[model samples]
Target: MTRDGAGLRVGDRPYRVFGCNTYYLMAWAADPNLRRHVDEVLDTAVQFGLNTVRTWAFNDGEDQWNALQPRPGEHDERVLEALDYVVWQAGRRGLRLILALVNHWDDYGGRRRYAAWSSTAKRADDFYRDAACRRCYRHHARTLVERTNSYTGRVYRDDPTILAWELGNEPRCARDPSGLTLQYWLEEMSAHLKELDPNHLVGTGLEGFWGKWREGRYNPPRWLGGQGSDFLWNHQPDTIDLMSFHVYPDHWHMDEKATMRWIREHLDAAAELGKPAVMGEFGKRGPRALRERCFRKWLDATTSAATDTEHPAAAGALFWALYHDDYPDYDRFGVYRRHESTVDLLRSYTAR
Candidate 1:
């Protein structure tokens, strides 16, 4: 995939990212009994006309489930093979993937784990500036990019199935309200990833916060000056090929109108920057009717933007998540195959 003007294209043909997030694919694929869940979700994606999927590619620390990197610079071959399986299977189904390299939170031993492994720093935010932590991150990234998929026999860097590599999941540095720390880190890491694999795109997995430098009245009160990221500044790095932001109106205390504004703000920014933007994650929790209403509104806003011939609109939007019957709806945001109404809504949107 490549960017042309404000939109994305594949070998001269236009491409839009209508997709869903399946963050647990790697873990489930590692378990023989649970691997079917991965297949089930992807099959559903195809059935719905969805073409892209976002998932976590990192699992650090020894205690984490299916920890891909149980130790710094070391990995469990079995788990890595499982990841390879995910890449192979997704490609087989003609689906593109956006793989996040790390997490900002500690759920899968993210920044906090890296900080612990490399220094005495107790705050997860310290991972951004620590030299040792940066080294470990680069190492892990190199391993993944250079990895030769056991199933496909193709190095990850050379694989066309990968749409992009996300820097981290919603990266932030609350300790530095100016957002310079996180900004610099993103610039450095994105440049490094590009040096390693110039064939693929790199993105900052940010939540679309406005930093002190770029704050405006359009921003939500909670993000008046950002949690520690400048959406525009963070994407200034030349190596950063794609712009990404996530939305959770319920969690952010935003109503439907505010949510649409937030998305439009990012799409406008992406157009100014000459890059394609994606609503990497978005969802609401409540009764089915309420969820459907919000989803329809949000999808309408994004899809409408895609039709703008004068300016580049959002490349596409992906819902909060996709899950199968085998898994519990742990987050309430999970959209299962049995939810025919919701499935139909997403399917219709993708078809558009």
Candidate 2:
């Protein structure tokens, strides 16, 4: 994919993403007994007309489930093969992927694990500043990018199936509210990834937080320059091809109006930067009726903005997650096959 001003293009045609985050693909594919589940989820994506799928490509530490890197600089070949399977299968189905290299959270032993591996680190955020932790991250990035998919026999960097390489999942450095720490980390990491694979796009998996440099009324009160992510400054790196931000109104204490405003603000910001923007993740949790209503509202807002002639439209929007019957609705944000109404809503939007 290539960036065309504020839009994205595949060859000469414009490409707008209609997709969902399915973070379990690699883990599911890794287990021989659970490989079928990965197929089931991807099949559902095709059924819904989604052209893209974003999932985790990183699992760290020895104790974590489906740990790809059991220890610093060490990988389990079996799990890596499973990830290869995911790339092959998704490519066969004509779905592009955004594979995140790490995470800011501890769910899959993210920065916390990296920090633990660093002798100079005292906190998770230290992973950004510590040389040892940064080295570990670079090693992982190289391993994955240079890998030749066992199933496809194509090096990951040469594979067109992978849409982009995300820097990390909602990367933040709360220890430095000025946002310079995370911004500098993103610049260094994105440049490194590009140096390894100039064929694909790189993104900062930020949650659209404003930094002290650009804080104002548009920011949520609780996030007024405190999350260590400046959506604007972070994307300034030339190697950063796409701008990404996630939305979770319920968790952020935002109502419907505030949520729409947040979306617009990010879209407008990306337009100003002359790069394509994607709502990489968004979701609502509650009664079935409320969830469906909110989903439709947000989808309409994003779609409408895409068609506007005055400014650049968002490249795409992906909901929080897509899950199958085999998995539990652990987050309450899961969109399952049984949710007929929600499925129809998403399907209809994708058709547009």
Candidate 3:
């Protein structure tokens, strides 16, 4: 279940991931009729030869729809059942998942909600250090991992359908630009997750930022937003099994050329640390052709490097998203099924 020199392995066979993100999977699965939508998405993933997926497993607070934890330590059985269906469905279809536990952003009222529930008006950074917030998160994590799946009649801790459990979605402590705070928080939470589910892998859902204190060979300029996290140092903990990073050149306003370099840094860090690494998220805007080219470059690099490099630790890349046709509310980053050329490109990589 751990990484060998080449990368992650199932026994002696190397398990290279051709994956994509479906952040709204659980949301879509909430309704029995809409559950088919989840299947369709997974269907496309399988058809494209993608063996893995990354999804949001946690939606906190009362206001968010399909909220997993409507209140601290309490869960909505209906929503949980929907997610149980997702896990079982993905497993039946032969797709493993990387389930993120929390979000840094407010899309699902993430860490901020935790702070609020703890009776504080503090920001996301405060959630890590706050005693009440940490306790709430600990309870939430425990409650989630221990819950037996109603649909599969199996405890989540025993499910192989889950590839890994992520600490959070792009966790960052902007207030503590030094990275020490985030590092401490990761140490505690990562260890806690391992104790809760030793059978599954754990990864910090970091965006591969190398904080000031622990920069290795490359130190990206601060303007590029490489502060508040030391990706390499962060993953060095005994509890973390995988190193994860995200790439969004268009959103970050970085040149397309920087994407490959960012990937190289993380891969190098993973290789050096003797752990597997994944580009868990990446996307771009503008014309479809440009996006296709960027994605193709990453796929090519990952696949080609597996054989060519002495230290092959790049597990694979997962594009930002894959939305079905007629899903409505399309975004620039989502690769809808109608985007035939891009879909073809993603499918081609899986064929590799």
For candidate 3, the 10 contiguous residues with the lowest summed lDDT are 215-224
Clashing residue pairs in candidate 3, if any?
211-229
Q: Candidates sorted by TM-score, descending order?
A: 2, 1, 3
Clashes of each: 0, 0, 1
- Compared with the true structure, all predictions reach lDDT values of 0.88, 0.90, 0.82
Q: After superposition, how far is residue 80 of candidate 3 from its true place, in Å?
A: 0.8
lDDT of 1 by residue, 288-310 (tens): 88999988988888887777888
TM-scores of the models, in the order given = 0.97, 0.97, 0.95
Provide the lDDT at 101 for model 3: 89
Candidate order by lDDT, decreasing, is: 2, 1, 3
Root mean square deviation (Cα) for candidate 1: 1.3
**Top lDDT hit:** 2
**Deviation in Å, model 3, residue 210 alpha carbon:** 1.5
Clash pairs for candidate 1: none
